[model samples]
Target chain A: MDLKDKLVSSFMAFEDGIDVNDPVHDIRSEAIKNFETKGFPSKKEEAWKYTSLNNLQKIDFSVFPKQESALEYKDIKKYFLHEIDTYKIVFVDGIYSSYLSETTHDGVDVCLMSSALTKPMYRQIIELYFNKIAKKEDSLTSLNTAFSKEGAYIYIPKNKAPRKPIQILHLATGNEASLMLQPRNLIIAEENAEVQVIERHQSLTSNEVFTNSVTEIFAAKDARVDYYKLQNDNANASLIDNTYIDQKDNSVVRVHTFSFGGKLTRNNLNYYQNGERIDSTLKGITILDGKQHVDHYTLVHHAQPNCESHQDYKGIYDGSSTGVFNGKILVDKIAQKTDAFQQNNNVLISDKATLNTKPQLEIFADDVKCSHGCTIGQLDEDALFYLQSRGIPKKEAGALLMYAFANNVLESVRIPELKARVNKLIANKLGVRLGFEL
Target chain B: MLKINDLHAGIEGKKILKGINLEVKPGEVHAIMGPNGSGKSTLASVIAGKEEFEIKKGNIELDGEDIEEMAPEERSHNGIFLSFQYPVEIPGVSVTNFIKTAINESRKAQGLEDMPANEMLKKIREKAELLEIDRKFLSRSLNEGFSGGEKKRNEIFQMAMLEPKLAILDETDSGLDIDALRIVANGVNKLRGSDNAIIVITHYQRLLDYIVPDFVHVLHDGKIVKSGGKELALELEEKGYDWVKQETVA
Candidate 1:
């Protein structure tokens, strides 16, 4: 059977051991039906023009792993921001690895979605916020919802802040021949609360692992939320990340995505300004080579007045790699005095690399300020020569220029250790060691 | 010492520096004064091994070694420095880091280890003080948002740090105020020694009054039409380039 058909037929068996009568089960059934109807998005669609899923769908991806695998903390410790302490919610091949995870309930909920979905004590929150903000019509989102069994579930209480940042890591071992994972995460920062989260999906061996993940974030009044996504999986891994954020009055939410290594990665980031004076910031840095592909599709809906949204994404493509950035801004008729700015800059370091960038702005209100700038070109020859004239070799000079080009998006990274890790990754990706520490 | 023997160069088949010949010995400062578009900058770039200018005839020799085939950085390793008229603004690299990288790369080419951090810091502090640069300015991005005078001063500061054998100051005094001119000239004068040479390429003679040159050459239409003593700069400043252009044409 085809992969979609196999997933559709396996849903019932997937629900056999779990509670079949739960309300989430009905939602899962509805989601599976939606996925079965629409199947997968194709390039004919405007949004999927630059990205294709035909090759991914043809592969016979096993919907589930028969047995869970174990991993040593030392083997994968480099993947985490181990420079500092964090609440970790880790999973191994769709199974929660309690040994590798450090969860907490200290006046907040930093636990698993499986626990929240099955336990009755959390039924109220699960009913109110689960899968509510995510778009129902997105086929890939539906696919994730149909199999959203285990992921991170974080809920910060009102007027409380997490003692440290939280890390949601999904590790896929090559236990199965070819594995497909759909992990769903729900993050809610209550009024007057603050939280930071880092998410990653990693593959252990040189085995094909495709992950379709979904995360929904809600920032209530006066809440602050900072989310960082590190997508540097192995060469055989691919990820499709769909994140939806809903921010309330006086709330601030920032999402920074660093895409350095992966076979293919797609990020569908959406932000909705639900209240006045809300601030939404979306920034990303993508440095890819060796036929790697990354597409960033971002949307910000300014639904209220006096809200602001800033989007800046920089990419450097080398070898035969490809990149796409489609940023959309929607200012409603009532969202006057809204300030929205989007900038996408890309550099093709090799002649064979390709990039497609588009900025779509649909502004209904006349008084709103919506501006976007997109540029695609090679590195500046003059800048390269300038550095070379200063005695830095041409290769190192080009790498330094690229590092500076991509470092602007990292300016607002609040965590110093995370920023340092990204700096090192950028240097490694560019294949040069900077003379000075970044 | 630097030698240019009938060096013919141009960009895109358009001749700029045509049959330019000059010689400079150690401890000598040669000021090349010219009119606008008279190929003074081209000569400086050619000597620094800028590849954009195609040299069709002759060669440039630095201290008896043919450097015409060398790359710009290789020439830099050989102690050739061209202070750009308009230095490129790098947004993220700090002034300290840029100079450190330059110095270390040059040292690496000589098979030397990286300068010790404390020694590097000490040299940077010393050079920065010689240029009257503030500690905060050293940490800012190189030349980004710098005023014209500040950019010239920063270039001089880099020249001091590198301590090249041949320093080509191309229009280094164009953007400077009187105070900045004095500071930059003071820095250059301090760095001058019998083991090195300086080539001052400028249209005006105001800077020559500060860092007095040993010889002055007037270039017109890609050729050195006049060669004389330090009094030539003051004479050119008084009579202007029209007198030289007429002299060359006649």
Candidate 2:
């Protein structure tokens, strides 16, 4: 059978086994319908021209099996439990592990979306905004919606700002062959409320796995949200993550994506300013080596007047690896006085390594300022010689200079704990020990 | 303590230093006066082991050992220092850190242990004060955003810190105000000793008035044309380089 027929057959088999009479099941069925109409995008599509997913469609992977083995709290504590005081939520194999999660804030509400679907108020909000901002035309988003069985739901009440950040850890563990995991998350910060959200994705086993996840963030008027995504999967894993952000009038949003591991991964981040005087900042750093392929696609849209957006992404590719970056800025006709800037830079260590960067700006309004540029080259030789002349070995000198180059992006990360963890991961990928001494 | 025998060097297949010879003994200061493109800086760089120039035929010795085949860092470890005409600016690296690393590396090459941090800091402050360099300059990035005079002074400050056996100041007096020239000359004079030698390469006699050389050499067209006492410098200052070039051609 063809690929579409096989996918249809697999969906039919999944529907007959799982319960489908609830509201969540109804949403899943509608998402499947959307997937059937959209299908998977090909190279002919403008957005998917540089990044081709034909290899993903050719794999025959099974849906993640139910994890029945009881996991001890202490065994998984190392992944989520840190010294910082914050609200924590843990998901094992794409399903919420209630026994391993905790939250203590009074004005905040955190619960599993599957259980939260039973409440009318929660259902009303999800129906209003969930999956509304993200494009269903893309197969990845459609696939994530079709397999959105177990995910997290976070809500901050209007005008009430929580004191601590909310942490979500997506832990994937399965002994089966080629497990496919999909994690869906929805976060909404009401008007005038402030929140910090941290998302981490990790794998327990070294087997071949595929993780397709989607996260949607909505910041209401006068609200502020700091969102961080940390992806450190096993070397034998692949992932496709999509993040959609929407900000209203006078709201501020900052998103930091740190990608250090994965055999093949793609992250699509889009931010939309739908109200006046909104500000958004998107920063990311990807460290890869040894045949790894990491692609980052970002889009910033200014639909209202007097909005500002800034985007910067930097990467270090070494050892016969490859990286692709495509960033776009779109200013609509009504987006007068819009200010947008984008830059992408890469450092290639090996002669055989490659980087394909395309920075674009589309401005329809006459009274707007937009600019984009990209740079791809090796490290500065003068800088290297200066460091080596100071007794640092050639390798250590190269690594130290690379660290300083990548630190420019890391310095924008506001959370101390998350920043430190990301730095450790970057050091590991670059094969350089951190200079931290007690 | 340093010797150059028939040194000849060039860049890009063009010969610049052609069959030049000089000897710098301990407790002596030598001034090399030459016209423009007369290979004064070439001699200094060839001795310091800069790799860009090709040594067509020459042998450079540091303390009776052949140093033409040594690396720049190796030569530095062997106590041969060159104050470049245009010192490079290394951003984001502090002066103290750069000097300390150089000192530790040299010491290690001599099979000695690293110096204590407190002792090193104390010595740096003392030497900096002697050179009239502000203490805050040590914390700034090495030579970055420094004025020409400041850059020249920093070079002397580094020479003081490294304490090399043979110091070659290549055009160190150029681009310096009168006051800065006095300060740099004072610093160099204080660092002189009976066990070390100094080579001052310049084109003018204004600097010779401050740091008098024991022997003066007139270099023209890739070779030292004349050798005499310190009075030769004053005569050259009176006649100018055009007279020397005409006399050499004659």
Number of the predicted model whose TM-score against the real structure is largest: 1
Clashes of each: 0, 0
What TM-score results for chain B in every one of the models? Answer: 0.99, 0.98
Per-residue C-alpha lDDT of model 1 across residues B1-250, encoded as one tens digit per residue: 7889998999999999889899999999999999999999888888877778899998888889999989888988889998999999887789999899889988988999999999999999999999999999999989989999999999999999999998999999998999999999999999999999999999999999999999999999999999999999999988989998998778
Question: What lDDT score goes with residue A27 in model 2?
Answer: 67
Top candidate when judged by DockQ against the true structure: 1
Model 2 C-alpha lDDT per residue in residues B148-228, reported as the tens digit of each score: 999899889888988988888989999999999999999999999999999999989999999999999999888999888
Backbone clashes in model 1, listed as residue pairs: none
**lDDT for each residue of candidate 2 in A211-282, tens digit (9 for 90 to 100):** 788888899999999988877778878888888888999999999887788777888998989999998988
Query: Using alpha carbons, what is the TM-score of model 2?
Result: 0.82
Where is model 1 more than 4 Å wrong at Cα? none
Q: Each model's TM-score, in the order given?
A: 0.98, 0.82
